[model samples]
Target: MKRPKFFYLIAGFFILAIFLAGCAGQKGNEQGKSAGHPNVLKANWQDVLSQAKGQTVNIYLYGGSESTNNYIDNWVAPRLKKQFGVQLNRVPVNDTKDIINKLVSEKQAGKKDGSIDVMWINGENFLMSKKNNLLWDSFSPKLPNVKKYVNQNSPAIKNDFGEPTQGVEAPWSQAQFVFTYDSNKVKHPPKSAEALKQWVKQHPGKFTYPAPPDFTGSAFIRNMLYETTGGYKQYLKPLDKQTGLDNIVKALWNYLNAIEPYLWRKGETYPESASKLDQLYASGAVWLTMGYDPAHAANEVKDGRFPKSTRTFVLKDGTLSNTSYLSIPFNSPHKAAAMVAINFMLSPKAQIAKSDPENWGALMAIDPNKLSSKGQKQLNAIDRGKATLPSKVLANHRVPEIPAGYVDYLEKGWMEHVAKH
Candidate 1:
């Protein structure tokens, strides 16, 4: 049974190779399954706070607005670091969808350790993340600010598009669609879709909108659709429940084409995005530029990006409005820090700064009435700048957003009906 010396040496070498291969495989498997386990659930606020200190949290958001970038970078980051000993890193993205996509990839690769601590997501992007189970568990209810300042039962707080948030995301800001025009150039701004069409024809080559798929352009269609087909009430329900969708959408197409001929370049092309259109308006190449943010013109004016004469208006019929939110990713390694950051952002102090025109001029998501008399006084004193409308004016013209499903449908439909046509 004894083997030759050379034979035994060869056998030992083969066994050693198998052992090395097994070790390498195990190491690879571990990396592939590197899950983020911040484990903030079942912990008290104090415990979470203690754990969060000295941690760095990354917040991913659309970086289109320089004011927003500065607000978070300068105003918010310092406060978070000073108060909680936590570092807030800003990870500006071109699209919020990219965060969901990144999380989805991480999940597929069995990577539990993900980089996105929090994301500024809403509407269709939130719907997609929820559908794919790309978000972390119910964590918002754990925050003291949510319990104190937020109305838990309001439909606006409960839902994102049509999907229930169920304590997964925290409401951060409110946005309403508004058209920005140079007051010196636009004597009488359009009040409705028909009026807008007439104005476009009269002032040929003086107006243009960002192409559809751009957030601002997509919103323009949705606002006009409300005026043309009826109002937003019909679209409040789920997409499947609504009927005669095709015929209803046809009216929107006609309205768009009618105005297209009078667009800045004769409808042969469009500004690639809202920012591009803003640049055009700033330079007086176009008379109008529009955005979902009511205070956007004010911020632009403060930054000298838009003319001092720029003013904002919503369609007399109605203006589309919705809430944007922050949520932790499913595999975020800094769950405690993420929760702390979100809670702080929801606090009255942070919201007031966000609402200030000098900072970002974003609408406060916090229910202002929920604050005490002193808190209310502080909030009321923040002048939202001249180009921004009063709260009552924006709220009076405000209309609810359609279900996210409908948003997707229109984005695709625009390509077929309007963009190509």
Candidate 2:
């Protein structure tokens, strides 16, 4: 009887150890999701949507463009509210670079619950944010639209200014460099950097680009760097990796300086902002203006801001094309809602609405070939207006952007080299 009692006691001890082991394993799995996101990554789409409902996401972005502002306020916000039960509150800043600086400050202050849920970001801002680890985990891949629509193999999708996105940002819209001219004033547009220099010399005080540190102006310099230097392919590597970069930039400064005397105000002063430049063009103070938006000239015409003769043209060699993205902050309290919002923005239906010039006139970020037959038909149906170039023409001349470091270097160099002299 004593031996049988001892055997039962041993069995009870063994079972107790097994139960404790299972509990420890369960705790470890819970701790694995330590980002304080409440398991957004592991949850299914339905669960994410359930968590996103009634969440108000704060979207920070550049608020200068009237169409961009109207699109967010009137179109995107209402649809997001009705469809997902998520509220999108857009916080506009004069510059998006400030948003990056704010995130850096928030991180240093050890603020665990940041207010920025999603931000419209790209280029040097994205680079700085990634360096500081201010972005949330690899959340882009988890977005259903990105998985279905975006081209997974494209180099542009994988990298931002040569920095790996690592699934931290979702591409929303694409814009390319195009010169806007009033056809009544100018019969033929220049097709290359050299041709533009001659056009300025021949038609003095009729053309001018906004000063640098201005986003459009800075892009203008980058495109010139490619045209003046041997094409852009050589500069695709990191800026530091480029040999004789100091010497290569001199040609750009020279080209710009050569055209300085013929510029509006004789190069003594430049329109302070792209908007100011656009105003000059509107008032007929200048006959031409430029921007990253290919549809910009067309939209201006439709809005009665520009003449009906307004037309857009790209360089013969190549034109700069950049994609802007939506990113989630590291400490965002509503990651689920941000993801849901970004995913919706990437969808075919939303992109189609955004593509209409009356809406936003932005080019859809997703590939057309990847879309369903119905979706592709809708995208193809967008008029894009007479001022906007055909898709095939823009596509043929598109060039990938140089790394951000080069952009920063060139923007500063313009101030020292071209602006001062």
Candidate 3:
């Protein structure tokens, strides 16, 4: 029996709709599941060591510091090669975004293996990569050296901004926001927002921060928000969502508005990154700079990047503290090797070496007391700049970090307000 014309047309239309829907669903599924596929080359540490014996693992690391690069080449790579027979290839990047961009490009090209073996990061970048399904999951627990040297309960073992690392990313170095000023230039530094404003007006063009999206820039903004909002003392917990946005954030905006024009470059432009801010200080363009790596300035001084008279401090308030972590890309060709690298990074010997002034001077992930006697001696022997901002100063001055979500929101808002203007 032949169907009526309308019935035939409706049947054809329905069939086409179903087929299109199925295709759309398949695409969505593929996109969702792309970050996970057993076909991806992952191996246990021993297996990876065997496979990579004399092979190279491209380690994408932030390369702003010459000492850090040297550490990788002279120290980390040599040790890995000597012990594990793995050749480490350092792919230095100025920003973690570079790696993210590369991973994205690789994904777009459908290149599955032989990509970046390991990357160093933490905070928003880690979350962004994880949320986008850009990184491997739960490989931290499987490293050959996971059981050694690290205390899983420490803040360093966790992700930046209080995010759960979930063993997807291995913990690397600890860092804190440190404020540094030229002792010869600024005899008495301002200790608070009100004081800082007066000081900035007195010393225009002598202070500036790295632009936002850089960790230090965002950290400055976070500290300002914390102080103005009076919620800094409680920053570790999730923010109060029940509070009305306007009511809670009103003071913060007001504080920023008041201080915006007074910032170096007259609120117009900011240094591109924290390292550039250090350069600005070295050039006498800015008297002050901040770094997430607390010992950064000291390292700079030791290397002649800054005057030896330059000293680091926190505000009368404590400096912002956070950890930088190592994460594995979901498509990492050698997951086990990446894991081994991260684990090695967390070892006491590595941490101590990383903290030396000639090195990166990043704080150790493990507690100082838990370190071996030699490790403690090494940690103590390092000057780490004088801790002039005493425990009381830090305790009383400690401000809260904004919710992680607010960081991105504020960046967009700050751009729209300041950048567009």
Candidate 4:
């Protein structure tokens, strides 16, 4: 019953082919799983919605702005509840770092089910969370809306302050740095860093920025650094902490030092936060107030927090622009609900609603070209209030943010060289 050598060889070949085919199938499954875990990556969109029903997702965000809080509470919350059967619980944190700290603590304690489901995060905070393994693993790519509407190749989508997002965070909104001033007070506003410095010298006690570590203040410093260092080209790569501080940041310190004596309060102290800086501008203590939110001045004008003549402007050399993102904590108790909510937020309907000046006034993160005709019309219909600069203006003057590591170096250098000096 022994087979001939040719028959034996043929049988061996068939067995080897089957084994290799089995191995390939297994490898393909592994690759599929690696793309996104099955728990968050459902077989269909309906499956995600079905599992998300009746779940309460807690979203932790910076609740500094009453308008932002109201928008979430009044608009987004109700929509999620009605459409997805998910209760959106808005957990207001004074700073995103508070949430990151809590997540770190939970991770250290080996907690499987953490309280925070979704968080508003970007830049240094996002880098920290991702580095510390505090964020969920690549769930953003699983969302249908993101896959369809988001331009994944765009730098704003791919990178957060020069650090790769790796699909862990979902972009929520766009912001650009802008300075606000009363048109009556500053007849000819400074249009570049050199002009701003000269303006400060000419109008001493009239201009100041928030101390570093505050997002807006940090941005102002970065802009100055870019201006002095011949435009942000040299600082785009991953930072070599001490080398960058010594070689690149020395110029920044020198620039700040030269301007220190002419700064408000003779550079004796800086406003603690952007809100405090805004207060100074409102009370006529300072002529210049700046923020990452370009629409903020418009909102302030409407609310009568700022004068009717208050207007927003960017530097001629362009100002930093970035997209803020939402991410899930690593140990979220309700992953499905969080995914459903984030997907909904990325929808054209939600983006249009958020673009309204009365609501949040954040720029749409979704590309208009990808949107349907109805969606495009709704987005276009939003009246970008009188105080808000035109979209084309912002776009023309937009600049990229330097890497996140540079932030800490700049802040520390400011404290040592400028604040202490």
Candidate 5:
């Protein structure tokens, strides 16, 4: 049946509107493709290098250590700028949470371009960022240095505190738990967690840990848990509220409670952070301190903060060891430049320079076995310092980290069962 002209005109208008809307949606999808997804750079290596030229990559990292800051600012930054024509802006953050919070806020606001290009992170922070979809993905495998030198199968490389890294972050350096003591004061240091308790009892007010939630303190607690329990094997899987709190962490609380009265300040107070605990050790107020970095004692001694006789040791059973990583934010504005910077960091030259005790004193994430003979020789030439424990000793006594979920539960339990009690 033939309709009126007005009806036919309205029908034609509707058809055109529908077609336009479809075209607009297609365009939007195409735009999204061009913008690039996380870790999926649409460009090849040369293209990426070209795109990164003249770009500035802002790196956010914990600013607790002057030496680390100096290494990046003086050595890394200069090399990046000279070689890649990229500007390196090191943004010092008191804590990594500040960076995460900012990223979350930016995501909530739908900000497409973010300020943070790269971040130095690991452990629970890495887990949190990955879980929240705040990090880019799977880019480390593409980096030439990582592909050639990194031991991809190593647990230290594959996991961050038992949370699978999944290539979301590129390993920056390795760390292991170590106790530092003034050799003049401690003729013989505790060789195990059990011995540590007796030592604490015998020399009251001479030892203490930084409060939990501080990175080093949390590690110290986990190390204790491993020693108290049979091993860290049971904590290999993901944890839940019930099992994590009730079964897994119960023994840790008991141990802490038993040793609490012997802690510095008679268990009434504790150092707020690792640096504070270091201060106590430096001032001769405490005989022993602890940290995740094996070379930290050496670095402190070099800085004249720690006594020249300061020495580091790991427990007989083992000490926790893990790799820290540098990750890009999901909304990073300069993905290529960030990748360039991270790739440079993984290079043999950078790793060797970073491992020097005079510089950062960080363990290289790159495997020496994978490097050329010259590179191996260079790594061997770096002095690990008198205070630093030998790499072979560290490797022999290395332990794996527990899952990230268990961390907060343990920290809270410490407060409830040991701190408050």
Candidate 6:
């Protein structure tokens, strides 16, 4: 009897231990096993949007163009106010390089918060900012507006000028190489690089590009390299030190050298900047000029900056096109507001409004199909210019691009070349 009783007691003890073990396993799952996760806060976009509703966001942008400044002030800013109660104060700078320098200084000073809210950046500036850890972390996936409204396939979303975005910046517009000519000045326009050089020679002091490091100047060099190299496959890759400069591009340099003597002001001087070149074009100092904005002439004409006789065109080869994006500083105090503003910019309504020629005249940053039916109609209405080149024009065009690696090296080489002569 005593042995049987002891056996029963042992069975009960084992059962209790098993039950407790199961309970312990259940508790572990409920609490979650990760040591670093506190599970204290919920990642919520609604909360962020609410917090940002009335906040002020300071945006730093390239202020080189008067028309752009006016558009931002007259159109984009007021809408942000009427909708979100957010106030935007634009900090205009002549050079984006200065903004980077300021950001670097702020970071070094240990001023972590309440610095800059948003930045308008692309190309070399975007790459350098991302490399230096100046930009804010990825907030794109967290925004409802981004998930539902933004066009994921647009070049703006792909990354600007071949640089990866990593969701650190929101895309705003599409820009392509646009060559504008005044019909009064030239009855026949050069359709190829070789022809352009000949035209420059035939009409000395009629053509010029911005100096190196400038957006247009750098792009022009890249375009020339692309054409002369015969293809852009190798250039689209990272530039290597071994072949830092391609001998194939010698033709481009030769061509440019030959035309420098005939360039505007004898190529001893340039228009100082891309905007100045546009001004030169408008003032009839130069018969032709290059623009990244295809509809730039339309805007200029609408605003009385360019005559109606001016027309825009692209080379037979489609132009090297890209997008511009907005980024936030790593230490932005109003990050939520910045993200909200970006989402709003990406929204269909705001995007359509921005697309209007009378407003911002910016190209849409979304796919037309994804846009609301209403948005699609708005896009169609605003995209008024001839968007394609004729077959004959296409044959003369070259898809020129600079290898990311060659950008700095080429700029340096070009500077040296300029200095020696």
Error of 5 at 120 (Å): 1.0
Query: lDDT by residue for model 6 over 119-206, one digit each (tens)?
Result: 8887878888977899877766666666776766653466555677888887776567768888777888886788888899999888
RMSD to the hidden true structure, all candidates:
5.4, 5.2, 8.7, 7.9, 3.9, 9.2
Candidate 5 local Cα displacement, residue 6, angstroms: 14
Per-residue CA lDDT of model 2 for 1-421, tens digit only, reads 3568878899999999999999998876554333334678899999889888888999999999888988999999999999999999999999998999899999999987788999999899999999899998888989899999999678887888777888999999888999999999999999898899999999999989989989999988899989998899888899888888889889999999999999999999998899999999999999999999888888899999999999989999989998889999998878889999999999888888888888889888888898899988888888999999988899899999988888889988999999888
Q: Please identify model 2 stretches exceeding 4 Å from their true place.
A: 1-37
On residues 65-97, what C-alpha lDDT tens digit does candidate 3 reach at each position?
Answer: 787788888888888778766778899887888
lDDT of 4: 0.88
lDDT of 4 by residue, 265-351 (tens): 998899999999999999999999999998899889888999998988989999999999999888887788899999999998888
Every model's TM-score: 0.91, 0.91, 0.81, 0.89, 0.91, 0.83
In model 4, which range of ten residues has the least summed lDDT?
31-40
What is the per-residue lDDT of model 1 for residues 1-421, given as tens digits with 9 covering 90 to 100?
8779999899999999999999999877664334322356787889889888888999999998888999999999999999999899999899887888898899999886889899999999999999999989899888999999998788878888778899899999999999999999898999998898889999999998888888998998888889888788878888898888898889888888888888998989998899899889988899999998888898888878888988988888779888899999888878888999999999999998898888888998889999989888988899988899999999898888888999889989989998899
lDDT of each: 0.88, 0.89, 0.70, 0.88, 0.88, 0.72
Q: After aligning candidate 4 to the native by TM-score, how far in Å is the CA of 398 from where it should be? A: 1.3
For model 3, what is the error of residue 384's alpha carbon versus the real structure, in angstroms, after optimal superposition? 3.5
Candidate 2, poorest ten consecutive residues by summed lDDT: 28-37
lDDT score for residue 159 of model 3? 45
Query: Clash totals for all models, in order?
Result: 4, 0, 4, 0, 0, 5
RMSD of 5: 3.9
- Residue 335 error for model 2, in Å? 0.5
- Residue 408, model 6: lDDT of 84
TM-score winner, 3 or 5:
5
TM-score quality measure for candidate 2: 0.91
- Per-residue error for 92 in candidate 3, Å, reads 1.7
